[model samples]
Target: MANTSVQTEPGTRRPGVLQAVLLLAGSCMPVLGSVLLTPILPQLSAEFGGAPGGEILVPMVVAIPALMIALFAPFAGQIVDRLGRKKLLIIAMFAYTLVGIAPAFLDTLPAILATRVGVGITEAAIMTVCTTLIVDYWHEPERRAKYLGLQTIVTTLAATAFIAIGGAAGAAGWRTPFWIYLAAAIIAVPMIFLLWEPNKADPTDSHARAPKVPIPWRRIAMPLIVGLFGGFTFYVLVIEASYLLVDAGVAPTDTPTIGGIAALASLATAAGGFTFTRIAKVGVNRILPVAFALQAVGMLIIWFVGGVPGVAVGAIVGGAGSGLLLPSMLTWAVGSTRFEERGRVTGLWTAAFFFGQFLTPIIMGAITAAVGSLPVAVGVVGIACAVAAILLGFGLRKSNMAPAEEVTATV
Candidate 1:
């Protein structure tokens, strides 16, 4: 039977500010855990004698989790719906902490890979559940849009900070970042007490135990297109920016410095997200095409520009575009769905989004290997993103979906 137990309200009940902060904190930990190890991948390769075609291994550490998340996220939606968002989040936090630390003790590549796989599982659980929880907590369209923007900002800031710190720490010893996971893990402890499960699920009510909502593929089509192109642009930049810098005469050790500079793109994204609430009155559909155009222009700059200044320009433009794109796409998707099916819709959207991220490294790695220059491969990927953006622009126009009502309730 179709599930009728889920709440139909467009926004979450008034969970206090403290509880909301705890929930956002819980969401941030897994993202930090997932990317914190990126800077140390080369060190791991050398220590473990990873193979020559092994550049893929470095990204695999990050991409594998995304791949697994894409594979299992649909099922995870049902699990969260059956259980509760907080319950899965706690379990995911525990798994993230343990798996994040396991690699430090391992001497072999296979063992490290195994631990990464565990990290992937934990990431899938955390992401799928936390997104659902956010929907539950913020029902107002405008408030939810702002919160989603904040969420993206926090995620980008965490990723940027951890990557920079991880690179510096790796210079001291590769194991140092893993220790940081301990701190992220302990956060779950306080979260356990602070988070309250919604009372909508009555234990005495058997009718509440309804079947899970099926995946909402139809409503998600536009978001998936935007996500795929947006993810492609972002991941391609991340995977190949260091190489591009290196090719232009930057040293390998200086790669992190270049990466940090490129990370300013995320900052631009955050800025765009923050401003979107005010500008959303301009219309999401109208704004979306502009976002895609900015990203494409950034890619063009990266493709044609040969120096640090060019890369910086590209990052800022692309970042702003992405920042505007993600929240708008998410708001649009959620607006199209009923509250009861929000989890399933979000799960599918995230899965598709991450699937593009998962594929970027593998595809770029193969192209890099075949062509022997990372910059050229990334340029190709950029071109592809540009094409996709153009295609998605037309698709959104043709769909003619109505804008979602803005929610105004405070946390």
Candidate 2:
């Protein structure tokens, strides 16, 4: 309820490191929903073995939130634009904690899946608002790019942690991992005191009274489409690398080696994120293609190269591209929008990304089935990404996805 302006206007204080760190922490919430329960799906299936639709509903417990995020993020964006960012984020944070842990006590699969819907809806708001706020609080391009890159790095790291912790905690019982939802409430504590709304203008400000500018939907179409590809490629390694390793002859029980390769891939991704902060000045026009090119190269290696060495190499290289992919596409999508329309633009980008994630497995499955090989399916996707990289590199040369030049409000 305190003043919500984070800008360094005459009176408002500019948000610094603490705010960025909090936003990064908040960004990891969806990752928990995505990966935290991954290791416990078998247990969940067993727990509700007798329930109607248990087989399908069980996998949905992990997938439904992402679908909700994809479905509702644009609506959440509208809410952020109209209702303000901090209030929606705070309300959703507490709501997230409650519904997030609800499964611990639920008896039926349907009931638990319903709570996952709540988790998804709240996550839609949480992700939209947190991302909007990160750039809002840090308008300076270097600072903004740094945090954006860090967001990918931190969340990627968190996904690994969540999976491991989920596995470890599942040793006690499937319900125990749900307790980790407490992280949201714990993060909400500092947020209550430190996080403030960006651009909370006084009634007297002329621009504050000006009519809201509509988002340039046409201008954003290609970027969103490109983001769809980026999103699909981004999650390819994260979701499919384990199967890739197994297919390459690693034993199913060789978790440490598998985990090591996965971890190496993650570190490679974090390296890509770190690279983004330094290369961001080149603009998304250039960086976008490079990211995809890297991904394509890795996938091609998997198809043509073969063996555990090839698969491991492919994962690491593909992950590095993924690390660069998100931040570049995000900047490309929302960098031109002003404060009035930023939330909606960011929401659209978030939707495109998550929707691609939702489709990745289904699409990849079809590709694998049609071709009768996982590496070949991945190669086909990689070729598609390669074409996109070439096209974007040429087509976007004239257009720069640079952040809006002015931080001040404009009518």
Candidate 3:
């Protein structure tokens, strides 16, 4: 169901290693924005603690970028489909580098927070275009699955590294970590030379003369719904692993132990990403349930079995599920659109996924307070995953997640 439009390849070149490498690396910019500032949140709060609304605004530095992606990516998608992909992506990446690094030099808390908003808006464009181009470049199902799955693996691994980088950089000063934003500019260099606009139609082609159609919102609705859930489960460990460790008796001051276990869990997520293509041939219907199930099993382990060992083992189990969860959702969401609407499709899916991520902590916080125990709250989410897995695996037919059912409607 991937776009099969006959593209006039950029000169004689086809998308190869350098293209894949750049796109995958580009995909990580959003991950850097999301997790890189997390380890330094406490430090930021202390520095800006005296400012009005500092308590709420300081944490927004990490969360607001994602919230922006959720709110604005659909508009970014509109721009990509209307103008050009590579042009917008290159501009956003460069903008991201400048805006991303500006916070490091700003003195006031509100000004710093304003820069973070700028970071999110640029991220909305960068993340959407990077993903849309991946689908554009790789037309083969196997090739598309491989690279899409790699997006998850690479970004998941990057999250772990960025957390470590943020923590290490924070030691110098809270603002020191913002210098890390310079990497976006570095990644943008080859992008100008190596990347091409994938769907530019020839001026005289008959197909080009045909009017375009709207996004297949009806077809994608199910996939995006499932994607929202996948995104929610995807971050359970990244957000809650520390709390799980603490509940299991690890000291709040034991940074080393906490970080070690989190790293191990991240590896488990990467392993799931690594194995995704091997199992991707089974299709999204089968993959969805298993991904959610593995996470459910891991969370259940942590719920029933108390102690450091339980937390460690459960995190590994849940982490692996998260690794597989993302690519499956992406593949599901994007398979039905054509070249003209690919950007819009990818953008909607991105919005759904990140909106789910933005909602995770807020929803989890409510659940935890309602239950009055972290373990019980986690147990409730685990149960929901179990139910979802069963329903998705058996309740839905293969055609329900049909990548093969490509929409051919044209104006």
Candidate 4:
């Protein structure tokens, strides 16, 4: 609010490391929101067992944020476009910290789940603004790819850390992990000084008034639609991996051990995320096929091999694929739109991505009910992801919709 315009001409000068680090830091909040509560879900259920439908309702607290993001991200995007990125981000970050910590003192499962909705609302704005700012700050496609890849890497690593932290905190008590949400406030303070609205208008200049271009509905819609499936593919294993391990014979009480296995998969994800810039050279069309193939082979391995070793190996392979998939879909989604509509497109992409995540459990549950096994359901999803990737890759290349040059060029 002090002065939105920090630069006379945007995308001319390189952003400092501090800015990139700050954006990357903010990007972790949504990822943190998604995974931090996971390690504590069992404790939450036990504590609230007296409540009706506590089993389902307690897990909803784990899942409600994704639903909220899916429902409200587009609106948050609109706000970002109209009100300005930095302002919404600052406000959302503060709100996220407040709402995120509220559950620490809540008495009822319903009350806690309601607070989770607040967490999701703030996360919607935070994710949309943070991603838009990254694109706004970096002009070159290669640099954007690098930062987004790094974003994935940081997110994956942060998730691994948070899972361990959540487990450790949960060991102390169910509510202790909620304290970590205060990390958002720590992030917001630096952001107040370091983060700025990119490409702000100069009110003194009449020529600064720019003509609006109609949003390319098809171009923007394609990646988002594809991202829905990408999100589904990425989350299937993350959501079901523990169940897969248990179904294979691991003890249900072994949460810490399961978390350790997940941390290893997170390493694999970080490996793939770290290579995103190099992979971007191949174009998303080519990358998509390879990513899904890894997932397909890995899922098939789990289905046929059976047991903890299989689950662990399959997860690492699948995690690598998911890591690549996120950045590829993101790059594809935002590549077509320029400054004017990137926020909205990014918001829609966030909505699509999280919506896919939100749908994963329900879809997998239906598949499990029909098939009578969670592993088979997971394998079915893997096969579907593989088929889609291959078919889409062929069409994307043949149609030349995003030719190599077009994919690499900054909008």
lDDT of 3 by residue, 1-411 (tens): 212233345333356677888888899999899777665655665678779877556656776787788889999999988998999999999999998999888999888878888998899999999988887776556677778888888987987787777766766777887899899999999999888775445332112334567888788888888878777777666667766776788654454466567777777887888777667776777778899999999989888996899888998999999888887878888754577888888988888888787777777778889999777777788898999999898866646565432211111
TM agreement with the true structure for every prediction: 0.86, 0.85, 0.87, 0.91
Q: What lDDT tens digits, residue by residue, belong to model 1 across residues 42-123?
A: 5554565456546567667666777777777767776776666778888888888898888778776667778877877777
Q: Which ten residues in a row have the lowest lDDT in candidate 2?
A: 402-411
- Return the top candidate by TM-score: 4
Which candidate has the highest lDDT of all?
A: 4
Clashing pairs in 4: none
Error of 3 at 28 (Å): 0.5
* Model 4 agreement with the true structure over 163-237: per-residue lDDT tens digits: 778767777788888999999999999899887665546332222245555556788777888888887778777
lDDT of 1 at 115: 85
Clash list (residue pairs), candidate 2: none
* lDDT score at residue 194, model 3, on the 0-100 scale: 82
Screening candidate 3 with a backbone cut-off below 3 angstroms (N, C-alpha, C), the clashing residue pairs are: none
TM-score of 3: 0.87
Look at candidate 4 and tell me the lDDT of residue 377: 84
Off by over 4 Å in 1: 1-13, 45-53, 199-213, 369-372, 402-411
In Å, residue 268's CA in model 2 sits off its true spot by 1.8
Q: State the TM-score for model 4.
A: 0.91
Clash pairs for candidate 1: 10-139, 11-139, 12-139, 140-407, 141-407, 142-407
